[model samples]
Target: MTTMLGVLLRVYLVLGFALEVQTFVRLYVLSTPIAALTPSLSDPALDNVPAFRRLYAVYCISLGLLRLAAAVDIKNKGLLAALAIVHVVEAAFSIAEVLVFQHVPPQALLDEPHLKTTGFLALLVAQALLFAYGYMTASTIKSKMHEW
Candidate 1:
């Protein structure tokens, strides 16, 4: 049976993909005015750094692929541990960004309280599960051994 963490990891990656699409559209297609793309996609900074935005999108996609790799190789405890840590860190970074940096304007969050709150809740859950499941999973795999 698949673990809940596995399922949620997949969903989170796909969501990351969707978010990348939005960021790409805003930066490339919609021509949303800003420099750096905000974590929430609500506002762009005053910098016109397409390269940074493009690379960030690539980072998201690559992390998704890495998660898939970790999932496929269950015996590789290192990969699983790394995967979990990376995911948790990603979620934490997102939450921190929301707290420390500029997020969607207050009016916007107020306008769609349910949607915003749900998104925030999902991030919190993702962060919790990553740590809870990551090391526990690593413990299940044995390290190298020599048979003589």
Candidate 2:
């Protein structure tokens, strides 16, 4: 069980890190306009977006740390519960972002929206699964504590 939990944590950390990097490169190095990346939100001043990005970066960093900590503290029900809550929140946010915002017109709208929406939905499902697994892990840990 510990091994499985560790694997899940590492997977999420890797994925989250990749996304953070991709978003940064797309927004800055690639010279892709911010509107292209964040089509859902009304076009905002570059300055405002930067702050949000920075905060998001920080959150991702924390997520990585939390995953590592969860692996170490696998027996801690409280920690697992907290992590599950966070995952659910993230999933909800991703779903809402896709549904509420019109992505900048992709040259190939069907292909892009189809792919993006599918990917986002997949992420949401994955996150929900992880959250459920985490909650179960937490309950197991809690029950084991009573046994001890």
Candidate 3:
């Protein structure tokens, strides 16, 4: 039976990957929903929606790919350890997002009233959980004498 932690980890990865891919698709492809995605909950003066949205898409895709790889090789201490580092770094960025930092701007439309409250909260929680899970899983895995 899969433990809750294991399920949570996979759920986090899959949701993260799906959301990123969805954002990328909506941003670069069809415009049905993208047209309505110009969320203005933040200070427009400091936010670069297009630029940050693109960067965010790239970040999501890359992180999702890495997380997928780690999930595939969860038993490898090396991979898990590396993923743990990545998760912490990503969590830092996510924290910046929560704080409304321009360095980590919100993805376009993701902060809209419709999805704003629940979605943003979920992202924050998921980031924290993933970071904790990553570190714990990495430390618990087998590793060489010098490996992390």
My TM-score estimates for the predictions, one after another, are: 0.55, 0.58, 0.54
Q: What is the C-alpha lDDT of each candidate?
A: 0.54, 0.59, 0.54
Q: Per-residue alpha-carbon lDDT of model 3 for 1-148, expressed as tens digits? A: 2244555566666676677676667755653233234332244433346676566557657767766765665555565566667656655654555456534344643556536533654555566566566557654442412222
> What lDDT tens digits, residue by residue, belong to model 1 across residues 53-122?
6666566556656655654554456766666677677666655555546554444544565366446646
Can you tell me which runs of candidate 2 are displaced by over 4 Å?
A: 1-48, 103-112, 139-148
Q: Kindly give the number of clashing pairs for every candidate.
A: 2, 0, 0
- Residue range 34-97, candidate 2, lDDT tens digits: 5465434334564367676666546755766665565556556566677778878877775566
Q: lDDT of candidate 1 vs native?
A: 0.54
C-alpha lDDT (0 to 100) for residue 130 of candidate 2 = 71
Winning candidate number (lDDT): 2
Error of 3 at 55 (Å): 2.1
Candidate 2 — worst ten consecutive residues by lDDT sum? 139-148
Collision pairs in model 2: none
